[model samples]
Target: MPNIDATVTIPADATFDNTLQALRRSPLDFVSNLVQTHDDDIVRLPFGTQDIYLLNHPDFIRDVFVTKSSYFAKRKDISAEGSYLQQMSGVLPLFEGQLSTTYAPIMTEAAVNAHMRWDTMHQQRDFLKVDIYKEVMQITLDIVFKTLFKVDMQAKAADLVDAIITMDVGYGFDPIAALLNDLAPPVTVSMTSEAQAAHSYLLNFMLGLVEASRSAPLDSRSLFSWLLKQQVNGQPISDEQIADQALKIIFSMHEVTATTLSWVWYLLAEYPNVEAQLHTELTNILAGRTPTFEDLPYLPYTEMVLKEVRRLYPSVWIVGRFVRDNISFGRYLVPAGSIVVFSQYLMHRDHRYFVDPDQFDPLRWTQEAQAARPEFSYFPFSAGPRQCAGRDFAPTKDALVLATLAQHWQARLAPNQTLEPYPQKSFTPRYGIQMTLHRR
Candidate 1:
């Protein structure tokens, strides 16, 4: 393949330093601007001292993610060096299909629906709105514990949750130390020591859970028990591997769902009229009852609202893949071993697919409206075979939580406060969202 004219445009004002700074500070806004002014197919960004490529076009995204996934496995070169950041970097078998045959059934639509109502009932009884963030942490802990470990952490999971939250995502002290390590060799050893010290706290907690389960068979209802049955080429699963996969699934399921729901509440609080319409739909269909597996189809409007929020502020916003083989698309050819990224943040906001692009309109995602577009247009849960194994969980969880929460309580943003989306372990509120919950 010939090297096509680098048709990619670099903004005149977006210098290498400024571009990286922008990406670090606020990634969504940076990508949104590129989508507004530049073509969606490709844009080059310079981070620190390295050049990075950002791919936005759906066709290019499809080529990078679906049609060519084998050649582009998930790899994060930029953030993978730091131990504190590695917790957020590793991909589990769920995303890679290693656990598909073994683990998929537990997260089936019916199962997730059943789990969700239990969550909603508890949240309603607890008055979750005033303490929504903490409630999110508890729900994720319980869900992961019950689904994966077969044991309820119950009240004892607090220390474990605290440890998990302390894990970093590149920009914190770990990345800064890694940066120092690169700059000065003398201090590298100390930086590495500190990073390991921080990681040990979380690692030990996960290992302890694994050991406790072995001594006493909990419920045998979770992924942990399922792993106990698993054999790779005939060897039983080891404690180390179980710890990694368990920690992987536990954290993976927790933060993304937690932040997404936080943003859902933030969005609903931002728009009371949308909440009114959503409540109406839930009122008519659910009749002051909790949502079940059978009730979701009738709650299309509620689903649409959640989809719309996800489109605007997706939790897993930017996806990265390393190119293993040279692939050509249009005028550009990506060479083998090149790291490329496709931003859902940019593509979801592209004018070619969305009319206003920025407006939070749930109606735009109606079945008729969505069918009119290309298959790769919206990917909150990603696309193709490698998409999130837990995709079914989020929407089911959201529908149940949103619908049931609407029944007993109405909410709005506290005066003078608004949420700003930021990149964290996943897309998240830059500041904690504060809202006033009114009893309905």
Candidate 2:
């Protein structure tokens, strides 16, 4: 019946150029400062040249991601025309839901192998002191490669993750590099030569897989090979397109899932009581058996712990989308081409939706609590048509890994390892979460 006022914040006497310079200096700090002194859920930030809006409530999130998602497009600054870049992206056919079901055994085997590797590491040293990031990345890479390409990435794992880390969020969001990556691609080669090499290496690796798959039998299980059998509109997608999709699938599947599991281990280590409960659940439900996809239905606490971990530290801390058409929110008019940003980090911690929002209480996810919350309030993998292609796959993989690892070992924080969340494209530990593995 009436218009609601939106909270607006801007730098005193700010200019566009100065805003860009400020963000370049420290994205994390700029964001942290933006939220200070905020009393409302919707905060409008006119950051230099960007029309940034951070939607902190579930109602706004539903307007952006689900109810009116068609009016928005995933942000593409690196691929925008006038922004010194121009490109579009696509993914392989296996990215859909039905194909995800095909990777059940692949996901389970990777978890088993990680346990074996932990044993090997422990035997080599009195106690296994390891970075959770390194171990989880290896397991994710193994599963992605094994399921998608049927290749063993064991020896090449280091190089692959190294490149992925750099590309995903290692170098914070840089507008300078964004423009240069488009206009003068050679600048990255000169300024970040090692990164360029890793990027090239991964590119060549994908091209090789596609080339090799061309000669393989028609019924091969590899996704690249499987793509060769399909026709789109009575014709097959081009090899180049398939290669692009191959790389897309690998990047999406490996980086985000691995990062999330690393955080999960860190959270488990921090909350010993929670870990004990988890260990009990696995022991009672699994009874010394390996975790399988069918075991997914039987592991309720495992699911709750995962849901809680994601609530605290969503891999996709914040995501931005470009409004394609003007949209209206409560007393707000979001114009076409403006950037609408939302943080899962903020919404998940909102005291309105969560009780003791900062506390790690997996019990908060009991059926009663879950049903009481609004739908879009807890979307770690996002929601709507453009939601994560691997949404179903990640939890399956996480449960399998958590079940298998908790079954055989308990991880405790090793001394001198300080864990802090570093927000990037995906949130990551500033330094990897270090822990000592205790065999069960």
lDDT, candidate 2, 174-293, per-residue tens? 543332122111223242555666667777888877777787664355676666755556798877767777787687666578777887887887898999899889989998788777
Q: What is the alpha-carbon lDDT of model 2 when measured against the actual structure?
A: 0.71
lDDT of each: 0.63, 0.71
List runs of model 1 lying over 4 Å from the truth: 1-22, 35-40, 46-51, 76-131, 157-204, 218-221, 226-241, 416-418
Q: 357-395, model 1: which lDDT tens digit per residue?
A: 988889988889999887787888876645676677667
RMSD of each: 6.7, 4.8
TM-score of 1: 0.75
Off by over 4 Å in 2: 4-29, 47-50, 75-101, 162-191, 218-222, 225-245
Where's the lowest-lDDT run of ten residues in candidate 2?
81-90
Q: Backbone collision count in every prediction?
A: 3, 0
